[model samples]
Target chain A: MAAATRPPNRPPTREIDEQTDIGEVYMRSLLRAQLRRGLTVLAVVALFLAALPLLFTVEPRLASVRILTVPLPWLLLGVTIYPLLLAASWWLVRAAERTERDFAELVERN
Target chain B: MVSTDTAAWPAVLSVILVAVATLGVGAVGLRLSRTTSDFYVASRMIGPRWNASAICGEYLSAASFLGVAGLVLTFGVDILWYPVGYTAGYLVLLALVAAPLRRSGAYTLPDFAEIRLASRTVRRLASMLVVGIGWLYLLPQFQGAGLALRTVTGAPRWVGALVVGVVVMLNVVAGGMRSVTFVQAFQFWLKLTAIAVPVLILAVAWQSDGAPDPSRPQPPTVREATTVRVPDTVRLRVDEAVPVTMRGTLDGVRVDGPVVLETGRRVVEGGSEVTLPAGSVVPHVESVRAADGATWSQPLAGAGGRDHPTYRLYSLLLALFFGTMGLPHVLVRFYTNPDGRAARRTTLVVIGLLGAFYVFTPFYGAMGRIYAPDLLLTGRTDAVVLLLPSRMLPEPWATGVSMLLVAGAFAAFLSTSSGLTVSVAGVLSQDLLRGRLRSTVRGFRLGAVLAVAVPIVLSFATLRTSLADTVGLAFAVAASTFCPLLVLGIWWRGLTKAGAVAGLVVGGSLASGAVLWTIVFGARFTDAATSVGSSPGLLGALLAQPAAWTVPTAFAVMVGVSLLTRRSVPKSVGRTMVRLHTPERLVLDRGPSRREP
Candidate 1:
């Protein structure tokens, strides 16, 4: 509470350990940032996956088109999608670790 | 389908070698695992790369080893979604549950439930569901073993299941999680080599054959005169009548000469042998349609003869994408990582490893279309991977490659079965039998026996379905129940204990009910299609693929129930969230119950 004393010389980590109001704010902000990253990745995956069936359905003829003699659907779903998944996950891990590093810096600044 | 040559000996030899090697690897790690932490989670010291390999080793079951290719051989391109859904599931885990779950410091799913909600009831419910999902997943591994052994060595179905069950039980009881980790990582490399080498050889053989296109718009014809011996009574449909030399009873009449097969559904008695001339169309088993090459190669062309292929595909995807984190074995592997960052790194590498493994399955399916078309008639398309090597190469090479493939298939069975058994036994020992036993190790050993015993019995009793389909049902159940729990438990603070209980009950019952219905009725419906219909109606389709509806409903119920019971929210939620979200570097006063009891 604003009326409470500053608890002189107490560190921010102690506030978190004690579960003070300010500690809740710090945790909430970090969770929100992480949640945003997670949801963004999820939305991108959901859209890409959903649109694939739609593409094949609306344009059945595209199935016949071949790149390097492999069918489009086979190339897209069977082979290429895996590397794409790996890439997306790699990018996400980096972004998340960076967010955590920033949060660690903020919490320990005091 | 029977191989009488001396080559079958090598295949049998390879299986024995793999089994011995598995136990040997576990024995080497035996001394390292002494404490309860070592037994449960390898003391949380497994490095990222080793953990990733162990995860993949455990994750790629009989379904990935055999079923994916078989589906592709019979159904076509749409079935590729199985591998995609499988690999992408880890991506979702990496982005969402992997790091936070590791940070939660829970050894099992039930442990996580009790830690987050502080409720005994929720933990009990989660333990039951963990046992349920683990058993469901294990059933397919045993059946796949039977199928593989039969294909390679002419053994009866039960022999393979019994062998794998006994091996896995011994390993888990002896070494626990630490030894199993080393064995699994070793098996992953073994399996990759076993499958990848044969694929390369087959690819070269195809090239030398001028790389014939497999997508021709006609029924695949045998390049040479092929003799197919029916192991079981099969009802098959011949699209075009052809004269064939036969040596068995046809239409219940004894005939041993050239006869023109009629162009409708005919029931061939078991032990009948039919020899078709070169360049003749392959008659398809009743369960699958006789699809031309174009239809087989195209996506969503109704290649598998199912009523609603599109609905099934999407539903399968939904279940897999959300289900990976909910797997007890999978979550247990994450706990072996030292921290949240290592967990994320391990998951990322896992996605890549899985992707690399999956890239070869579709190749087997396509090659099977050309080289092993007789599998279509026998309706044992799941044997495509095992049989392709024999069909594609000459005698010596064929025998040798076939041996390697059978060994790889066995590796798939052993690694996955052991992983599932350990996780299930962990839960059992910790929660179910905690009061009865004095020492943790004795309890875990007893728990391992019970865990493997039930699934082994069920594998013998239940009718055999395709490996991928049975595994898919497991994912669906997990997706409906634990997916909601993990996602909400880690990310949301408002999730009350009552809400978690309500969601698990609703989601668990609905998804598992659909699974039970599909397993019992779906097999019978396929076998006796004339009695019911060619395809299941809308209700049957909905039950066949329940994840599309059940997952969302579970999420909704959890959120709604939590809001209504706002007053009952755990007072420690903020502290729990801090532990879950903050970086591991920032030491905080975690509660006394940080470790599993």
Candidate 2:
């Protein structure tokens, strides 16, 4: 199927190869989408980490709260943080992959 | 207590088993890894799952296996940040660095530097940092081995270090990267079982003891009459006065009778013995303050004696979050992925695997506080994990549990040291001995010997610090130097050769200089300042944890220099970015292929 289309639909591929204005636009769009997703994940993590210390400072009692015989800090920092990290990473992977997939389809369609 | 000979057998056997198993796995890889590509990156055929296991196996060093629990034992909730930061580092790596780095197709960090900036000077600078960081990181692994050995078996410290050094060198020299991958993956499981099984046994024992709360709001007390031995002369701060039977010298005078210890810092001479009655408060070494249960369990309460706890915390978190991306050994594992997406998947799995391993460490710390408070008094809290099993359990069970923990710790040292040797040897052979040698594999073998030998010799002469602190210093240097160069080089097109070089120099020197200062002058400086009746203050905190300042400054220098040298940007920047960003499935016409240097 790819071989059938390659003979006639060479213009889009040529544009990317020749560094034409259209190709530059295509590359920039993909880069921007991926970068935005990356930055968003970074911002979420930074906010989450920074807020924990501030929250502890604001309400010291939170540290003492216990759930199922485990203190709040132990529950949050030791146990809960791992799943949160995995979830965030999982989210980014899906988002980044989707963005890349969309760009791949767009380039191939042209 | 059970006889010393009975206890030694299990630990001794565990160490031997781990050593033989690690070398055996490497031998399997030896037959398959005959080519240069196989030696450097497992021929780039590893799938995400196996690759993730390999990365975690290699990444979880003595610091994670033993040091985290020890830190948590010494200082309560605040120490959790170390494990959190260590794992979260991979999150940051996945989000920013992983995929693009794999896409760049660089074998070593120096190769990445040259590929991105196209400058021989930048590559050379990066090569030096890789060797420096590798050696610095390996120092603690060797020391941790000796410490663990001495604590478990009555063997002299150097025996353990020599054993680990020889075993790791042989593995690296024989199989290189391919063999190390299998060995690391196998050890990761071995380590997981080694650490996990004991925690389960201890938890059961704790339950039988009625699951006593370790977070009580008072100074920790010995549940029974405990005799504490002081190895070196240490200053102890006693909170409340108590009558204690003493042997050896105290406060420059020899007294072997009962004496009332004052409620202040008392100098306890080396080789002194003190037996305190049951339910007495455990006096801590002056360096680690004794925290009451209420304060010890509270977050941000600052149990560690260091001033400016919040500042130190932030700096430590920053260094760890950014530094994982820059580690040469860690980065080299990512290149084993087939493409960009596999790299990301592998890192995500790594985060999960590391998190699973870390969840068991805090329990060890809390259990140690309840079962073995004497460690705090002895200033050997790093041995908390190794000693906990014996303190809590009786007879045969104690010996069995102790064996598992010691073997796990030894596995941690062997796997991490071999990983470091491979990375350092890879860089050494490629750039340092590029044209000087005929065969790549032979050069790598020679590099492996040089890499492992230096740190083993240095570990003997240097005073041992906590495993976590030494590893943290290596992270800070990596975060300051390569973190900036890779972040800017991959993402930003305007980054020039001049800017990258400037950032590496500024960041590398400052961070490493701080590390050197902390290692050599830190104790003397603190002592001198305290003798004159003043704290070392802000200057000391900054030097101890420089990453909070160094990372941002590195980013700034790279950007500022690049902006100033705008015209010197590489003409191939566009092509490089395309290669880095595009999906591997997209068969774009990416022009002429660049030759390997």
Candidate 3:
């Protein structure tokens, strides 16, 4: 690994072909935007938790908070939200990385 | 204790096929284990998809397969919280810990300790605690194997324990993390397929039979109490009651083994359990209306009545809810991926695999609801999934399902025990013998032996608690110790060396002592007076679940200590912070060799 007179940060910015790779650029930008707002990500999560009970299955008897009724909404929050969290985390990171690197490069090139 | 109704050949053949396939994966991994990184951390080269599968294999252990199903069957709706919390653990893991830990570039918890605290003593204590908890958790996997093998094949219980122990040792010794990675990855799919196939078959069978008689409404439950000549002075409470079939009666009474019990009590020894007509009343039996508007199928003792203690519920949830973040096997998975993002992605994948798997647990319990509801009576509710295949299908069809479950159970046991063994060995090697021994190879061997010894002993020693309960104990300990470390370490900049040392020592010791107290001597003081205020007192006792208070206290102590000694903070803090927040590709070498602040 030879040293390349390294800058402060590097984003994967080499253009393969301007006409062909425009889609890639836009997709990366969208991913990058989502990852940048960590506070918003957490806020939406808090909101989702507050709102999910309204979305419980229509069986009122089963939806009852009583022990016998098999509470469904808690199960959805407890079991199902995990994968979504993971996916959100991933999207946030790749997006966060792109943004951080770009900002660092902007500073370095200045 | 009874012969399986299904043919044994398919179960045997599939178990053999899985074993062979797993061994083949290990052998392939062996060929790839040429370097230090490959030996210890799979060279940090694995991608998200493959690593995610391996994480699932290791993560969904005996606790998931047998414990959750049994818990739901015995406790009804409230117990689904176990799986709920177990999976939610990853949500906590992702939200706080995963990315930064990976970015920290440490190999094990001890490594993390050494780097963060810059204290060798702190690192050593953390390593011992990791080994202690890993071995404690592995016991249940071994015990589950024994239970599974005996249940499935009528093989001796020791045979299953020995089988898992040997397989895990061989895999770890042969290729360290590399072999286990491949083996665990394959087992995840095999395990998923194992449970998924049976669940689908059973669901289709139920559909064919018109959906479990949901319209029948629960029958009027009955409990029969004849003065059975008491056998011994010690009374036994079945943790939860299920219908039982008995053969003999005491005091010259005509012994009818198949009668139902309306018993809402926590423990029942042995009795008859059959659904009777709702309106009909037998002369000898006492009728009890289902409590709390829930009916049975045998009424789950806890949810079906207002009778159960809330303290037990709090204890159980405490053990599971915070316990997840502390596990050795789960934490090790985070390190296998190439970067924090990968760790986060893999965790997400695990959530899908685990969530989909958990959705089927209630179905297994519900099957016990229909076909083999007898298991609940036998007080072997944990065996619901195992006994399920036999109860639902006709003799031959049921046999195939039973074998599928047995194979899946063994996979659960082997994958988890092996993963736990690897982490334990890594910690043991890196800390205990790391500096003492000049050669890494020698340290690996010692760690391997140390890892297998304690768990095998504990697996044999534990007799009172169900394997699931013991596993819960382990989770509680983990929640207390490591969960605090990871969560606080990632988010807080002010956590100091003295604080981490204090937390791991204070937190780890208390949690472990609580577990040991319950298992070893607590039952002896029985009125059974383990937690009844005689010794540790119920609440004041070393509650096995530590995170309820310890996690927060640990975090507070660390911060408080750091602030008090603000001038003593490490010079590397700025660099470490930078490294953690920086993207992986920005760094020149992927090695967490020198962290950037």
Candidate 4:
């Protein structure tokens, strides 16, 4: 019975075993990090977008305001929103990859 | 309007050029693709940039290419939400679904259903929904192509639909997803250039013309003696008396002489011609509420003029935001990435690419409002994108630019149709043709034919709805059904097979039923119908944009049913959860290894 239950000579080849307890920890942390980053970005962007309708409603004059000869709503929705989304996504992608890399490092060290 | 004699050759040539380009690119990719994996998911070796380009290519259908500018031109600032919501959807996808879905290692949404629930019943339900949503989505592409061709060349509407149908079928059956990716990626750049260069030239022309604001009290007028032809009987609402040369039939009276169009509406018969004097105010279609410069330029103050404006705005926002993730073609593209991380990166790049492309559309729309305002009278505002360049520029340049735009428009149709065909075919071949077709390729080929055929038949039977409106309905259906499934399937652990099926059936039926009603009887529920009662018609408004309620109901049913069937949860839920959330670096003998041992 002792011989039958003897430990394997080789160490676990893969850094993370998803079925095991430690693997679950690694997965949960990575997911938490990702979720946190995603939520942060989502909240900021959503608030910004949601506020546009409110601003137009509350101060109807805001729509007509011309900044550099362009209508306010046109500038906001048409020109600026695209770049803002691109910037936010770029930052989110960088942060997500960083979190994954750190998790990979932690697993490798273990 | 430019005569068909002059316009037909260039437009036809552009269409042929686009078809050849697409076929050539697809053929090249077919030669490169030698295995089943390549046909389905491009062997999971696509880089982030190329994948993102391909996604944008497929995602920017006729709606993005033509309908957006047209909507913006007609409705002003409120319509900008279409482009905004469209781009922002990827952000939501990136944040929530991107990585996890790729990590799930499912080739299709149905595959994801099977993998997560370990139930064939859920898979079958998903397969039906996928095919349904795909058919609904494909209907608009074919219709838009028909409209574009008929508007450009005097070809019968069916000719355009048939051409696109044949080209897309050939590409899809020949190479499947592998060919589609390259074709779509190339089309994206081509579409970008087509719109961008003309926009630049038109902007310069507009600046030269003193950048006249279209929102002035004076309505749009013809610059030249233009003879307008009505293909179908239409009601023209005149705000003031206007003298015009009438031919064929007007208000059922046949007269080939000058007549006065007084205030209020008059019917123009099919195959009739009316010539308006230069500087005469363009007559407005009864369906589109005529807006002056001030109202046209203002936000939410135009055609859908201020009644339940908030509800309409939020409903549309909800549909576009959530609906994108549920699009079968979009989801299938995620399966092409090697791992979850690559998928996330691809989504990030996609947001950037899509954002860049969206900026050009609104510019064209604003320009079209100024340059091609006659479309308002025709109620074919969707043609504004194609017409603006020719209207503004000089002869040869106009023809050249028009050709470019037409080619880009065709590319939009081909790329999107091909993508839709591959996805629908993937589901059809897998689910319906199982055990019958000896080879997967043969099944897929047959599936492609079925996918394109249904939409082609529907396109002929239906009246041409506004391109964006038709596409929006498809989005509503997708949002109501698959959005709930994906969000719950990824995030929730207790999602049972019974709950999924119930949610799918309930949500899918309600939204699609609303869509069918809208498509069939929508023309009768115009603005005039709302004036019959003091109170707004709640049913018509609800049916018009059903996503706000339908999506929530789906989520509620899914969650509630899931709770009731807790005991029915698959035992492998724990393992599935770990596999989904974990990074690709994590290795466990959950099943067959992706890499060879």
Which is the leading candidate under TM-score? 1
Instruction: List lDDT for all candidates, in order.
Output: 0.87, 0.85, 0.62, 0.82
- Candidate 2 chain B least-lDDT 10 residues: B526-535
Report each candidate's C-alpha RMSD, comma-separated, in the order given.
Answer: 2.5, 3.5, 8.2, 3.6
Candidate 1 off by > 4 Å: A1-10, B1-6, B248-257, B528-535
Per-residue lDDT, model 3, residue B15, is: 66
Per-residue lDDT of model 2, residues B1-597, tens digit only:
221123577888999999999999989989998788999999899999999999999999999998888888777888899999999999889888899899988888998898888899999999999999999999989988987887887677788899999999989988989999999999899889988999899999999999999898777888877777676677777888867788978789898989888899788887788887788888877666678777777877877566787888899999999999999999999999999999999998999899899999999989978888877776667788898887888878988888888889999999999999999999998889988999888999899998999999988874536788889989999999999998888889899999999999999999999888777777553221111101368887888789999999999999999999999999878778888888889888653564433
| True-vs-predicted CA distance for residue B351, candidate 4, Å | 1.0
lDDT of 3 at B297: 26
lDDT of 3 by residue, B1-597 (tens): 222334556766766766777778999999989766777788788998889889889988987888777655444555565676676566666655677778778778877777766778777877888888888888878878776776666566677788878777877888888888999988888788888899888888888877744213543222222122111122233232334443444223344566443433322222322232223321111011122224322222334232332445445555565567678778777777888777877767777677777777766765554454333333345666887776567767777777778778878888998888888988887777768887786688678878987777766653444556677778877777777676666555567777777777777777677677767665454321012212334443435343466656655666677688777776555446545545565432222474311
| Better model by lDDT: candidate 1 vs candidate 2 | 1
State the lDDT of candidate 4 residue by residue for B7-89, as single tens digits: 68999999999999999999999998978888888888889889999999999999999988887776777888888999888
* Between candidates 1 and 2, the TM-score winner: 1
Candidates ranked by TM-score, best first?
Answer: 1, 2, 4, 3
> Whole-model lDDT for model 3 versus the true structure?
0.62
Show model 2 residue runs off by greater than 4 Å: A1-10, B1-6, B255-257, B525-535, B591-597
Ten residues in sequence with the least summed lDDT for candidate 3 chain B: B282-291
- How well does chain A score by TM in each candidate? 0.88, 0.85, 0.49, 0.80
Tens digits of per-residue lDDT for model 2, A1-110: 87886655545545676777888888888888887788888888878987887688799989889999999988899899999999999988888888888878888775
i-RMS values of the candidates, in order? 1.1, 1.2, 9.6, 2.5
Q: Each candidate's DockQ score against the native complex?
A: 0.74, 0.64, 0.11, 0.47
Clashes of each: 0, 0, 18, 1
